[model samples]
Target chain A: MEIIKTSNLKKSYMLGNVEVKALNGVDTSIEQGEFVAIMGPSGCGKSTFLNLTGMLDTPTSGEIYLEGKDVTNMNSNMRAEYRLKYMGFVFQFFNLFNELTVMENVMFPMMLNKRSNYKERAKELLNLVGLGDRLNHLPSELSGGQQQRVTIARSLANDPKILLADEPTGNLDTASSIEIIELFRKLNQEQGQTIVMVTHSPEIGGMTDRIIHFRDGTIEH
Target chain B: MSSVFFYARKDAKKNWKMFVFVIMAIAISTANIIIINGFMDGLTDGFLEKTMDTSSGHINIYPNEQDKYIEGLGIKEKKLDGLDGVVAYSPRITAGGTLHYKEKFKTIKILALDPSKENEVTILLSKIDSGKTLAANDRDGILISYRLADDLKVKIGDEATIVFENGKIRVFKIRGILHTGLAMDTNTIIINFEDASEQLNLFNKASIILVKLQDGTLSGQYKNKISGELGIQKIKEWEQEIESVLSSFKTFRDISNFMNAIGLFTGAVSVGIVLYINILHRRRQIGILKAIGMKDSQVLFVYILQAVFLGIIGILIGDALGYAGTKYLEAHPFPDPTLGSLGPRFHLSLIYDASLVTMLIIILAAAIPALMASRTNIIKAIWGE
Candidate 1:
């Protein structure tokens, strides 16, 4: 079943009197539980597409349907609510709070929702990411791959239906990149976690269920 | 809200150096306010006590006719002798006189009291700094204030000649020195009642009556009680007679309030700069928080709570320091060259006022930066623009 759809999505901004079209007239859809990759060169608007789909930025003109519900015109607060309820995100920098311990960082999103059993759930998620023993350590004490794993654990804290990642392997070495990809593949195959990843590497794109390539702010084929 | 506090605590701990800097700034400002106000209150209290002891007493009875003596003092004394709140009373003859010590001449108020009965209503005898008090039989012994001695370069046992308004001159030995801390002491002299009556040509007549009341008795209440029997216009409470001193003290307090306002402004500006810098440093983190479904209000609340927490901790520490400093001053007062020891006094109302003012300044400091953070462009922040 189609879990996400966007019709004629466009995003534009003015940079000191020049209108820059970041995304223009894009149509796309993704099935539920599919591990999809979005690929393009620099300045081709792949990141813009991910931001719109993740509900982090507004589109200039479009309709976005998540599980058959049109959510294109939702206000910022409603978009935040939707993101909390159904979407999760991972970034290249692994933005874990440096001051908090590993467990506390994982527990942050759940803390916002005021969920019960957060301590136990956070520990459980840390263990699931194979970082249970490092729960008391700060993010500064972890390696790059370990920090990314912790970021993944944090993203899953609210039990979101879809996980969006932008350049997840961009900042990692080859070994860490492979480990992260394997982890994503395992989550998709075993738990049926829907994921849409933006990447520059063809090898990473080839591992996904399908690839959506883009150029000049629209789907290229 | 819980998440706001939780994140606020995290951020505070992470950036503790900056938090400590802001806290110390606020704490020092608050401490200055407390100390300055407390010291001023102590000075005012000391001045009032000295005025009551040396001149005004709790109540002063003046003559209805300024040029005449208080009529029927014997009858009034007999009526007031057994009054419940009237601890002691003394009749005094006050006359303006010119004093000559060597070549220096100054105008002075001559207060003549029966030394045997005057100690009951005034603290002059106990406050004698150099010589003994006048005895009942001592013919022409006089007590001059310390400030008067300093001005005339006279010492105890020196002979100072006084010329009364009636042009009668008498040379009297300075038997003692008085220091009462009130400004009136600087230009006043005390002489024996017999000598005053002989020199001023008064026959058994007194100019004013000083009355001491019992502890916890309000002088206004006693003044009201006696105003009807005596002439209403002639009865005056100590407060009524010390208007100039009271006004000067009020002016001092107003100046202190102005200094406190400056302290508060300085504290607020320092705190605001620190908070703004901290928000600037955490712009990306704030963006990430917004991206992950945190509302703008929630994000703003986190920074505000952080600032409030720092302010509260600072105020608690400052109050503790202020209390200890004032108590220490009370125990070991600062010794003045002329006025003996001076100490600081603590007023609880001042603490409440200072705390309220500090809290307001802190909130203003925190809110300006928090508003800026809330209105930050999320995309620009996330992309490090």
Candidate 2:
């Protein structure tokens, strides 16, 4: 089943007087339970495409369908609701709220959705991420890889349909990167979670079910 | 909703030290508004009370509009004695006279009242700076104002001669020095009502009757009663007679208001700048929250709730501080040369007004930054773009 689809997506911005096209005329789809990697060199539209698919940024001109429902023209409020309900995001920097404890950070998405049993759910997610002992520690008190694990635990808080990651392990060392990818592979193979990850590393891309390589502003043929 | 409150509470708790500066700023300004207003009220009320105590006693009954003196005083006095709410009343025979000492003399307004009755009507005898009030049998004894005595260079024992307006001359010993804080203190003389009546050949006549009411607030009611009973058309309440004096107090209030307004403005600006900087520092965090599904209104609400929390806590502390300061002033009044010992009175209405206004100002101050924070573009704020 097609969990995500986009057609002729375009995005542009202006720096000084010149226009910079970030994404140009991309057509793509991801099946449910598919572990896909968007691979590219620096400055490619892979990250932009993921952002567009996640509803973080609107395309200059495009249509996006999530689980066969058109979401391209949704307003910010509706997009926020969709983001909370249908998607989770992991960024390069493991953007955990520094002020929140590890447990509170995981509980944030559940709280946003007003889900019941959020505290227990957060503890369960934290233990699954293997950071059960670090629940009360602040993000700054944790290590780089541990913070990324917290972010991953938080992303799973609402049990999103699609986990969108933009270089989820880009800041980690090789050993931590391998551990993070192993966790992603476990979530994908065991739970049949759909994931669309953006990264530049070919090794990580090769580990996924399929890789969509990109160059300038669109996918390479 | 709960998200807004949770975030607001957590943010304040996590960075309470940063918010302390903002709260203290609000508190100090609130305290100043209360203290300044209290001081101004005290000064104005004290001066006005002194003026009223030395002159009018809540209500004053002047002579009939057509007569120089309210003739037939015996009947008027009897009616005044039976009037309800009348604590005391004094009849004064006002006469223009010229005082003469050895070397100098000045024209003065003479208020001749029975000293015993005058004491009850006003704080007259108690204001004597030195010497003693006249005994009922102490003939030829009169009290002179301290300013008048200074001008004439006369002591309490010295004798002063006065030429009555009716061409009668009498020499009286200065029995007491009056220190009443009014213009009357400069050139007024207090003589026995009998002596002035005899000298002017106006027996059973008085220019005005001053009536002291049990409650000062009942002046208008008592004035109407006195007018209706006595058929005196020239009666006035102290408020009606002191328009000019009250204008001076209005000026004091206006100045106090202007000063405190500036103080509040500064406080508001401080709150604004601090919140703005705080928003800027947390821009990335705000963006992350938005990216994670926090709506724009929730973001706005979080900051606004923070402001409300700050306002409530700050205003509470400020009210306590201002209340303490006012009570301290009341307990230990500071002295003023013109108004005697001055103390600020604590009125709940004043504190309520100050707290409510301060809360409004602080909330508005925080809104600008909160709006900016809420509407920030997610990608740009997160990326520092």
Candidate 3:
């Protein structure tokens, strides 16, 4: 089943008096439980497409349907609600709160939802990411790959349906990048966790079930 | 709401340096207000007490409008003995005189009182700083104000000749020197009533009468009563007699009160700057919160609660420091020439007023910046675009 769909999506921005068209008339869909990679060179609108689908930014025009529900016109608060319950996000910087311990950071999103068994769930997610021993440490104490794993654990705290990642391993060393990709591959294959990722490396794209290549603002065949 | 408090506590606990800076600012501001206000109150109160002790007798009676002296004082004294709430009463003749000592001439107010009756009515008789009180039989002795003696370079054992209003000159021994810290201290003299009657030849007469009441607050009531009963037209309460002087004290007191406003402003600014810098440092954290489905109002409430916590803690510490400062002054009073020693006084209402206003101002101060933080662009902040 198609879990995410966008039709003729377009986004624009004005720098000075000139309008920059980041995305123009793009149509795409990702199936449920599919590990899809969006690959392109810089400034090809790959990040913009991810942002539009992840509810990080609203499109200037066109419709986005998540599980057959049109979400293109959702207000900011409704968008946040959808993000919290149905979608999760991972960024290149692994934006874990530096002040919180690894366990606390994982428990944070669950805390916002006022979940009763959040503590136990957070610990389970951390153990799944293989960072149970590092729960009490801060993010700064961890290596790049370890911190990314914690971010992954935190993203799963609310049991989101689709995980959206932007350059997940872009900041990691070669060994760390491979380990992170393997973690995603494991989550997708074993747990059937649907994910949409934007990456610059062809090697990371090769591991995914399918790769959607883009040039300028449109998908390239 | 629970999450708001949860995050607020995190700020106080994790970012303690900012909290400390804001709290100290509030403490110092509160301390300054308390000290200045307490000092002003003390000066006013001290001067009031001195006036009642050395000058006004809580109620003063003058002659009828048509007469120079109240006729039949013997009858009035008998009626006063039966009056309710009358502690004591003394009839005095305030006369003008000129003094001669070592060829330096100065005009002075000669206040004549019955030695035994005066002793019952006022403390000036016993407040002799350097010598003894007037004796019942010592007819040729006088009491000079200590400040007057200072001006004239005279001592208790010396003699000064006074020319009375009737032009009768007499050389009297200075039996005592009085320091009551009033205008009387520098320009007045006290003489026996009988001597003044003999010198002035005003037999059975007085210029005014000073009446001591059980409570000074009832002076106006008794003044009306005295006016009706004794038919004295010009009777005045102690409050009326000291109106001009007390206004001066209040003017000074009012000026000092301006500091309370400045103190509160300083508190507002301190908390404002702290929250401003704090919001700047935590922009990404705030953006992350917003991006993760936290409502804008929830985000604003989180910072507001942090500011309120700071206000409450700062108010507590400030009250303690201010109270301690005032109490220390009470223990060691500042000396003055007019009112002897003055001590600062603390009012519990000051804490209530300061806390209410300080809390309100700090909340407002914090809201401006916290609102800015809550409204930050999530994508820009998180991605640093």
Candidate 4:
């Protein structure tokens, strides 16, 4: 069954007198537990599409269905509730709260969710991400690859159904990038964690189950 | 709510300097309002006590309807003296006169009364700096204030000649020196009533009657009662008689109120600016929190909790400092040359009310920033706008 489906999705925004079409007439579906890569050059709407799927942005037209439920017109608060329950995001910058320790950063979403077992779950996720020894370390004290690992751990805190990564390893070195890719591959293979990643790297795209290429605002199949 | 509290505590702990600065600013403002008000209260209370104890009794009776004397001055005085709650009553002949010592002449307010009888209602004998108060039989003996003595360069045993309104010159020996602790008494001289009546040639005439009440008697109630019974329209309570001093007291209160308003406004603005800056700086963090599925209300709760926590601590510290400062001043009062030996007093109720007001002001100051933070566009804030 398709976990997320979008039909003829379009998004337009204004920049001065120019209207930029970030996405146009995009029809797509991702089945459950699939590791997919959205590959495109800059300004091709890859991140915008990922954001719309993550409910971080709304499409100008068309419908978004999660498990056959249309959520295209959901308000910001309802979208947030859906994201909390079913979506996790990893940004290029890691986006870990600099002031919170690794353990606290991982537990933040769960705390907001008011999960009773958040602490134990955060600890387990940190250990799984190989950051168990650095639970108390702040993000600033961590290496680039370690910070990405902490971010991944944080993303998995709420046991989200889909992990939406926007250039998760874009800021890391080659070796760190490889390590992060391998971690994502392992999570997909072992836990069947459905993943959608936006990346310019052919190597990262090649590792995914399938790649959807984009040019201008439409998928190139 | 619990998560909000946790976040607020962590934030405050991490940024303790900001919290401490806000708290201290509020505390200082509260202390300023309390201390300034206390000083004004002390000055007013001291002036009232000195004025009342020296000349104006709690209630005074003058000639009714502009009459020079009550229809029966002796009879009215006796009736008031025998009334319930009447502590002491003295009938006095007050005349504007000129006192001459050697070649120097000075205008003076001269009061003629039996010093023994007047001392019962006023602080006469206790105010004497030297010599003795007038006895009933001491016809020519007079008591002069210390300021008058200094101005005239006269002392006890020096005789000063006073020319009354009737141009009758009478020489009376200065039997005692008075210090009334008030500036008005600087030119006051007291003489025996029999001598004054004889010299002024106004026999059986007294212009004013001063009445003291028993302790805890409300002066307003008795003033009205006595005025009605005596059919007099010129009676006044001590507060009414000392209108100028009371006006000065009101001026002091007005100034303190202005200062309090300024202090409170400063506290509000300080907290408001600090919170606004904090939200501006933390916009990215707020956006990220929102993107991570934290509700706007939750984020607002964290910020509001942080502010209220700091505000409450500030108010507590302010109240403590205000109370301590007031107590210290009460014990070791700041001396003023104008009101000698009077100390400033601050009521506990004043501190409590001021603290509550400060808390409310700070919370309101913090809310504007919290609302701004909550309403921020998550996408723009995250993108560093």
True contacts kept of each: 0.55, 0.53, 0.40, 0.40
Question: What order do candidates take by DockQ, descending?
Answer: 2, 1, 4, 3
- Chain A TM-score of prediction number 2: 0.98
Q: Write the per-residue lDDT of candidate 2 for residues A1-221, one digit (tens) a residue.
A: 99999888899988899989988888888999999999888888888899899998999998999999999999999999988888999999888888889999999889999998999999999999899999999999988899999999999999999999999889999988888898899999998999999988889988899998877888888
The DockQ score of candidate 2 comes to: 0.67
Query: What clash pairs does model 1 have?
Result: none
Ranking by TM-score: 2, 1, 4, 3
lDDT (CA) per prediction: 0.85, 0.88, 0.86, 0.85
Candidate 1, residues B1-385, lDDT tens digits: the string is 7888999999999889888888987887887778778888888888777777777768888887554798776778876785788888888998998889999988988989887768888777677778877877788888888888889999888999998988889899989887777665778888888888788878667898888889524988888787666653688888887776778889888998899889888888878898899999989888888877888888889878887888898777777777888788878899985457788888797577777788888898889899888877667778888
Worst 10 residues of 1 chain B by lDDT: B224-233
Measured with C-alpha atoms, the lDDT of residue A90 in candidate 3 is 87
Pairs that collide, model 3: none
- Report how far off residue A50 is in candidate 3 (Å): 3.9
Give per-model CA RMSD: 3.2, 2.6, 3.8, 3.4
Clashing residue pairs in candidate 4 are: none
lDDT of 2 by residue, B113-226 (tens): 887888798777678889988766676998898889999999988999999998899999999998887778879998899999999998999998888889989887887889
lDDT of 4 by residue, A1-221 (tens): 79989999999999999999999989999998999999999999998899888888889998889878899999878988888888888988888887789999998889888899999999999999898999999899999999999999988888999899999889999999999999999999999999999999999999999999988999997
Q: Kindly list the interface RMSD, in angstroms, of each predicted candidate in the order they appear.
A: 1.1, 0.9, 1.5, 1.4
Q: Please identify model 2 stretches exceeding 4 Å from their true place.
A: B63-72, B95-97, B136-139, B163-169, B198-205, B214-218, B238-244
Taking all chains together, the TM-score of candidate 1 against the true structure is: 0.88
Worst 10 residues of 2 chain B by lDDT: B334-343
Q: Of the candidates numbered 1 and 4, which has the greater TM-score value?
A: 1
Compose the digit string of candidate 4's lDDT tens values, residues B1-385. 6666767777777778876788898888888777777777777878877788777888888886757765677767777867899888888888889999998879998888877778888875577778887787898788887788888999899988999978999898999987767775679888888888888876777888888899524888998888877778888888787888888778779988999989988988888888788888888888878888877788788888887888788888888888888879889986665566766787887687787888888788888898898887876787674
